[model samples]
Target: MSASDDYKRLQLALEAAGLDLWENDLVAGKVTHPATRTFQELGYTLEEVGDSLAFWMEILHPDDLPGVGAALEAYRDGRADNYRSEFRLRSKDGQWVWYANYGKVMSGTADVGMHRFIGVTFNIDDRKQREEELTRINQLLSAQNQQLDQMNGHLEKLSTTDPLTQLCNRRAINERLHRLVSTGQPPSALLFIDLDNFKKINDLYGHDVGDILLCQVAQRLQSCVDAGDLVARFGGDEFVLVIRETGNSASPFRTRIEYLCARILSILAQPYLVGDLMLSTYGSIGVVCFPDDGWTVDELTKRADIALYRAKHKGRNRYCFFQPNMETELQYQNNIETELRTALKTRQLELLYQIQVDRNLRPVGAEALLRWHHPVRGLLSPLAFLPDAIAGGLIHDIDELVLDTACATLGKWQQDPLLRDLTLAVNITARSFEHPAFADTVMRMLEKYRLPAGKLCLELTEHLKAQSFPDAAHIIDQLRAHGVRFALDDFGTGYSSLEALKHLKFDQIKLDAAFVADITDNTTSQAIATGVIAIASAMQIEILAECVERHEQLEHLMRRGVDRYQGYLFGKPLPQSAMEAAMHSTLGAQMA
Candidate 1:
């Protein structure tokens, strides 16, 4: 065949295979037979290309040059069996498209004038793009799987661990106890520790400090126990320590239990550092032996509880053992419940108002606080007897009375312009507010007194249950429509404080007294207060400072943008007559 015929047939074969052959003259430093169809397929015309090595070099993407050179060098050095490279080339449309080439060097033979490189160039853009996309999808799936694994691990941890102290939770403790019993391990002593005066510490220091104290106590408890021993947070203000091996003999075991309990009491009683303040608290321990006190977790917990109360009853900061005659605590509680019932009916329960003032220190409103006048115990604060009332389910009755008296007081106040604008904030328990007739009763009182619904502010506590929020929202919305402004009481202390804000709209949030207790001296409290104020402001909700008992606290709060104030620095809770008189005095001064 003629050479021209052979060249034509080869070109036809290359075209049929979806490829184009190219020849580079190494000595001439130019491309002789260019990949014409490759350029044409990428939207480049023959006129756009000058068919020079420079043109090809200029079109090669800068990022792909090193890899292509590496492949060419490896083949030349005989390190690679074949020379192959995939690279991006700048197309006619000013876009980069992927192309690949396979080539071999042909030495200058007797007839050849110079060394020549032969190669076939083909478009691999679709395949390359698909491969890249598949890689990305695989990466996304791998990341998702890792996140799912993390989420599941977190869920498992939550089930077995206390979120706050990171100790074994009640469920975990129960499981551990069950496992020990099932395996018939050495008898373990379960010491039920109820921190003494924790409520007082929590109330006086704030929940922030209280939380810190709990964590510190958990750490101390862990430090006191052996590695095999388990220390768990059984409940709020409660802890359980399990001694894995109490030994077989009674004398040494009793001595060991005594020593451990005494050590825990001493260690726990030591002062705790919360923020900048050092506070002290003690624990009352109830010591019980497993398989001896009772077999199951429930029976052991129940008996331990009895012993714990016994320790509290005798005196706080001591340990007690479960005895047959330890049923005295129940009777005492029942007796108190009986007295509370009597106190409610006999008008011994009364309302007191603590003045709420603006930034200017002028009275804007008053929070209606409850006081109990026990016939035998003289006058007492709600803190003294409210627990019994709540425990006996008599808080709803107290709420009813407070609402009634507060409305009557509101009705009387409106008769005088001086006191009409002063709002009365009444605290309502969750159960009381959730009642079917609760909204009607409130509206009824407002209508009967002919008072503005704005004058009677209902304070919802931070401790409202999440499950009842839907219904609570309905009632709050109903009352809100009637012009009854709601305030979130104890805003920063609850677990779901921010969640509550998200779910229910409120006119104001009473920053918990705990946050205010040490705000002036504590930077943590300052940051928390500042952050909360900022959040509340973003929602257009007013911020009210609670327990602002010092001028420094008030100044700090004012600078931080608090809208209102209430505490001992203002006025202590007083009777309706006294509260009105003080308001009258303050209003007269303001007018003058």
Candidate 2:
């Protein structure tokens, strides 16, 4: 087709499609496009919109002109195949609106007369608005993401902290240790601690006082360790500490932990007063070295726990290291746990009884002691397996069995005319006292055995005297209301023992074996025993001395006017039948 005919058809299509078409002859610097209506709509006359290249450039926004010029130059230089531009332009009403312009090279000839170009423009105000809206949305989403990341960091901090003590939690400390090991950090130490019978503080004063004491203890721990060290709460009454080192055991790190343990023990040993209540506390600490004793979290904690067990076993209120021999102890503990589990299943546990005599040497009561009849190891005392059972959560089952057997035996013993008036004493641990079902369990056993509740005496160590006093009081009241009598065992040991006798109704006070065993040689022990006897006498509370082995200790206790005496001097713990025979042989003559 002829150029004129082709131009006419292009103009017709541009008009129909809402596009303004134009052509520029670069060689002559002239513009030509027969369709003049589009430019007229933009307030330019046909003559004004004529083939001058300058006219199009003049209409563009100043900032957009350079880019458009570069595009044209690039196309002409054969560096590009097309040119496209978007910019603001004046409309007929003098208002500026966004417009799009696009064109392609029509010829490659260098001759000015032959060079030609074609282009078009369209209104794009709506597209420009949509682009601006998307930019704003992107900015908002970026800001929200940053805020969410910050919130997540804050929540993580909160989750890993102890609120009251402001220390890391057990989980947090473990995670930190795991991270250190995984990242190949230097060696360190783990300090495992347990407050020795912390319950006594709460049982004597109140939980509020206990909480204050805990806060103070946390502060003391912080002061004892370096800033780099971490003190964490492992749970109630237990704490785990992580200490970093300077490659020298002689340095402050190792010494500091030991020093801290001693200082803590000393500080806690001091008596605490909550209002009218005064009490004392102590703690046991276990030490394990990282990369020495252990390289992982579990290994360290396990070793620390083993050491703590040794501390408690050796008499509490002290610190112990994870010695090489501890592995043997650990194995022994494992064996005990296994055997206790088996004993629970096989009903192989037995109860031995020790006769309780009155001040006149007349049998008035008996104490029930648990004995394990191991098929292979012969008989084992409670000392050999009770700790493991308690640690393994088998104490409840053990206590239940002990209670049942004692009730049944009491029922049988009550049938005898002489033993009918005698009471049977049962030792109850803190674990048994904490059992939520303890009341119902005791009541059911008593009912099932048809034993009178008055005939059952529950002996509790003075340990509870320094712990959660309100809870202890509630338990004592509940049990006493059921016709059961309470005895304060291990008296003169706990700081709150005297207060316990005064506040709680106790039918008897068992002088601690420590005091009784040394009464003959230790003037202080004898003085304490004499004072306890006098106090019990004043309160109308009977006194029972345990471990009265020596003639002098027994004679001294007897001279002090104790209500009862029980020890090897009377007879060792024996099976029920043997105890019955002993009573028949010793006291049978008196009855006759």
Q: Would you list the C-alpha lDDT of every candidate in the order shown?
A: 0.83, 0.78
Error of 2 at 411 (Å): 1.1
In candidate 2, what residue range of length 10 has the lowest lDDT sum?
146-155
Q: Which digits, one per residue and each the tens of the lDDT, describe model 1 over residues 356-448?
A: 999888899899998888888899987787766776778778888989998898888888888888888989887688777899998888888
Q: How do the residues 173-231 of candidate 2 rate in per-residue lDDT, one tens digit apiece? A: 88988986787677787888888768866776678888877777787778777778899
Candidate 1: clashing pairs of residues: none
Badly placed stretches (over 4 Å) of model 2 are: 1-290, 294-324, 375-377, 512-529, 546-560, 567-572, 581-592
**Least accurate stretch of 10 residues (summed lDDT) in model 1?**
146-155
TM-score of each: 0.48, 0.56
